[model samples]
Target: MNKLFFSAVIGMTLFLGGCMLAPEYDRPEAPVPSELPSGAAYDGSSSSSEVPLVADLKWREFFPDPKLQQVIATALDNNRDLRLAVLNVERARALYGIQRAELFPAVTATGGGSKQRSSADLTESGYPRTTEQYNANLGVASWEIDFFGRIRSLKEQALQEYLATEEARRSAQIALVAEVARVYLTLAADRENLQLAQSTLETQLGSHDLIRLQYDEGVATELDLRRSQTQVDTASRNIAIYTQQVAQDQNALNLLAGSLVPDELLPVDFASVIPPKELSPGLSSETLLNRPDILAAENRLKGSYAYIGAARAAFFPRISLTAAIGTASDELSGLFSSGSDTWSFAPQIGMPIFDSRTWAAYRVSKATREIALAQYEKTIQTAFREVADALAVRGTVDQQIAAQQSIVDSAQTIYDLSNELFTQGVSGYFGVLDAHRTLYAAQQGLTYLQLARRANQVRLYAVLGGGGNLEVAEADFTN
Candidate 1:
């Protein structure tokens, strides 16, 4: 009984000893710059009206258009890319679990029945025999020890990889939101332009008929009538193209939303769904680190460092302890009897004796760590640039939109005055057409610029690493 107990104790010790191969992991130091470039933001233009980049702003707060907010919300909820991203997170977590478990011992048991026969002929004494053995038992089990920290290093690498996937998910979500915003903005601009084109088409068509009547009375030249007709045709063509663009853009938005056309249809005037105005942009670049892509890079860097440790540990000798305890008896009743008990224990060591290529692996891991560090630094630089671009453009786009709006207003007034003067025979057809063209161009330009400005605001939020951080409100994750 004492021997049996001693065997059990030794088995446990062996099981525990098998887990000593774990390697410690540490983060590699990389010199990160203190601050992003303090250039004159926004493509480096000399503009005094520049606002510092603020990446934080809720999409709802930025556009204030309830309709667009609804669209964005719907997209966020139903997007297939988002669903896939979530699945990826699960996959990474599962891998982390698998790797993390490697540092611990695993135990399993086996039971079997075997029959053996031995035959000898032409020996000192010919012997023929058949034996049947039945085996059944259960005990602790283990494998290679982790004393050198190999498993620990591997586990750390896996954990970092898992974190990387999470960052990737967030990155995908950010991209999805950005695309939705851009498409929605385009929808609004296109719809507005279409309306303008239709209105101009009607006005020009009316003028075309008037010029025909004047030509019939021999008061207007054939040149004037043909030119008026040309203006009406041009407006009509533009409206057709604009109408097509709206349909195509809607389809594009639907694809991003990952919905069938029959499921949900966005309106042509998506500005009705635009987010709010006067949003708050929380101050600073701390929010940039929270961005999923940046976090992903950080995690990858961690993994690279872990891999270096793993590679270094590979250069050391590997030791393992193993043990098994069970019972074997010819009779079923003796299977659990003390007399039938059997056990085996082993300690093993392995070293790479002749593998000349091992040194290359260490070099590879070291190089990979360097690459990860560089990328980490580069990512920071990119983040700063994005924030600065968004910040610099906010005021610039605002000013441009305002200036363009003024131009549209001025052109409209000039067109109205020119049309009046032409009705009184004080202006030529060419003058009226010129004024109409100016108004058309200005209005279209204003619509486009307005959409661009709004889109920039959306981009700003995204660039600032907005969203997902409850503590930092008003950052632009909606880009």
Candidate 2:
């Protein structure tokens, strides 16, 4: 008899295990072009034969700077925002475990003793009497059998949510790497500008002193002396401005790193740093679908679909089972004696007949699933736009940098010629002052352009989701 009952239980478990009500999932079509947009702004080579996909490239290999690699590593290890993202993944995992536990019955062991006094009028002995009882049992409490797959659907939703959280953590890590690299590059450029300003100020001060001596001997006019003094003041003011900018950039870099950054890791000059090698963004835009954010969105959509399955199951009858087997006696010593055994087996069936809430919930779940589908498509579109914008900048930035460099070189030549002409009385000091001003502005502009070019490369790598193998491990928040 026991073997027949055990076989029946096993058969039922197997039958219910295969009953999933959720619709089969298929990935939606990507909402982007078949290939990257082509024009003068995207004139770069797209030869897949020569270049590896950006997503396959490790960040350390892309950056190639020891200090920058170290800074990125530190940010991955300690950045507060990234840490929070990792913690959220853990929270989701635990929630999924909780939902998974619902598939199994909760067994509990219970033991108790009770004593009661009976009134003389009610007692057959016609005197006040006391009754004592002791009991011990093992029982299962309201375990839903999941005949309609309601519990299974909810468990699937939780699993997808956990997966979405994991992808979100990866997205945060990639962004952190890109932001740290960009801020470090900015700091390096500002420091270079500060040094340039100091050098220019020193040269201007020497010119001012020379003009003052010439004026005292009536060889130079007061106008020339005042022009040189003005140049000196301008250079000094620029030095102060660059100094402030450098300090602010350092603070920004430190914030991204989530701690104080050591001076040794800071770049000395923008020119000394080697920018990341240009990546060959493939003609096909399908690779953007592999981005962590895109994957997270799709998982969220799947979770919403699972929720719809669970809501639909709510309209079906729910079956629950409760059972207990134990012994009871008037004395604790006799609780397990022969003839004292007691047992119970109770199964419950509940069908929603008059409940309007179940149908309302089903509608809400379907609406939520539609919203998730829209969001998933939107994520893909945003990613495509970001990659296109970065590639557009990437295609033209090198030429822009080269043109700015030429402007700086020509300005220097003109300034040198004007100074020689002024000393020989062939040109006025006003001509020399104008050339000096133009050269200073050109040099500053060139520095900023170089910084932008380098920063753009980092941005492109990030949008392409290129930092997955960056040697930074996921944070261990168990501590």
Candidate 3:
């Protein structure tokens, strides 16, 4: 009987190690165009081999501004959202480790001692009697022998989930970097607007004082004085509005950074904040596959397939083992003595008979797989649209900035001509007032256009999956 049992154990080991019931996995086709769209909106912006792809570039290299880089680094270190993502990755990794340990038997050790007294009626001698016993054992208890790959499938699923969580952490960091840059640029632009408002207020105040002086001397009309007052009031109102916007932008930056931003790192004006380096979308839309969010979605899809494998394996027979080798003795010191050895082996096999829940579980796994497939496709589609939109903006922003600059120049010239004519009595003061209004509007428009141009660069970098190449190890939060 002992020899037969040993042989059966060896045979089961070999057989169980060789079988896997999980279905084969095939990656679904991407649901997007092979190439990006091209036309007037995307002219001259098509990907070229010579152009540098955002994927190869680091965040520091893409954003050359020292202050902005410092701010982004601070955010990476302190942002609560990013910290949570890192923690999730750690959690998933730990779960994967737990699932993997089930592939092998868990051996345990146990020891016990007991003393019991027998009643007088139970003793043959009609007297009370006492007995002592001791035992020690090393054994495996009901360890499931994975004959149909169920444990293996579960392990695979856990591994994929862990990978998916790691990708999510990368995605969070990438988003944080982009958000910091966006808010930084916006703060700079608002500062510039405030300065412009202040300068216009100074100019309008001078014009208002001159018109008041002339009206007091009976040389300027009441209408002219009132018009000057209106210009001054308009400039004053803008100053107040822009001042509030700048404060709000600063608050936003602080929230993203998760701490107070240093004064030295703040942008003084739009022109002072250097433009970020340019990036290319590459010729093929396949680049989107490398994006962190898309990769995360794919990992989830693979995990769902692994779940289906586990579900399928549940239909097969389950084998378990319970075995022990130990020594027992009536005397306390003789527990490990010669001739005291004892052992036990128990193997069990259970076949599924009549449970409706098993079939329902299989159906649920199939439904999960389909859902994952659709989500994977949707992620790819969303990534494609983002890149295309950024490219379209890239194609036309420069022209818009150039046109706005020209308008400022023309308006400045008109304002100068009108002022000269009014002083010489060749034109009315209303022409001068209209020219001032036109020039001020043109200048403000130019500032906004420049801001848009710079913001587009940041957007393109983000959409193309730049800024995720930074290496990050599992964070230690024990402290």
Q: Which candidate tops lDDT?
A: 3
- Please list the C-alpha lDDT of all candidates, in the order they appear: 0.72, 0.86, 0.87
Give per-residue lDDT, candidate 1, residue 439: 91
Please state the error at residue 376 of candidate 2 in Å: 1.1
* Runs of candidate 2 exceeding 4 Å displacement: 1-16, 469-479
Candidate 2: residue pairs that collide: none
Q: Write the per-residue lDDT of candidate 2 for residues 63-171, one digit (tens) a residue.
A: 8988889989989988999999999989998998899889889999999999999999999989999999999999999999888789889988988888889889888
Per-residue C-alpha lDDT of model 1 across residues 240-262, encoded as one tens digit per residue: 99999988888888888777434
Q: How much RMSD separates candidate 3 from the native structure?
A: 3.1
Model 3 residue runs over 4 Å out of place are 48-50, 467-479
The TM-scores of all predictions, comma-separated, are 0.84, 0.93, 0.95
Candidate 1's TM-score reads: 0.84
Ranking the candidates on TM-score from highest down gives: 3, 2, 1
Q: What are the candidates' C-alpha RMSDs?
A: 5.9, 3.5, 3.1
Best by TM-score: 3
The stretch of ten residues in a row with the least summed lDDT in candidate 1 is: 470-479
